[model samples]
Target: MEDLWQAFVNVDSAGNITGDYSGKNIVAEDPYDFFFLVDKEVALSLHEYKVHLDGFKPSLVPKQSAE
Candidate 1:
């Protein structure tokens, strides 16, 4: 056993764990073996996603008839 590191794991495709894996402090040859790193800023908010708005209105309003 050595200094433990924390990371996120992709359960759908996980590798062999050091122990029974009680849901905490899992050991493995490499973090990439099971756990994966996720960029919160990128995944939560994509940088490539951008749109410019120019006050465009496409709604039609019915005009009231003068009495």
Candidate 2:
């Protein structure tokens, strides 16, 4: 996360805002929650969830799933 934060922002010996907005929502969001989706904390695996999502390809999930 620190490496990701460094990519979005830059600071010298003293801290300061030093990045371009470029229409990204970084200005209003908390960085701590930036990488997580809201449903990630839900109490079920994808197999147990009934909703049929269009783009949730299981073939690609293993590369990123910590579990």
Estimated TM-score per prediction?
0.16, 0.18
lDDT on C-alpha atoms for all candidate structures = 0.28, 0.25
Best by lDDT: 1
Angstrom error of the Cα, residue 59, model 1: value is 44
Residue 47 displacement (Å), model 1? 21
> Per-residue lDDT of 1-67 in model 2, one digit per residue for the tens?
2212211222222222233121213343434211212232221232322222236431212213423
Worst 10 residues of 2 by lDDT: 32-41
Which sections of candidate 1 miss by over 4 Å?
Answer: 1-7, 10-33, 41-67
Highest TM-score against the true fold, candidate = 2
| Cα lDDT, model 1, residue 59 | 17
What are the per-residue Cα lDDT tens digits for candidate 1 across 12-44?
Answer: 111222221112354555343233232344223
RMSD of 1: 20.7
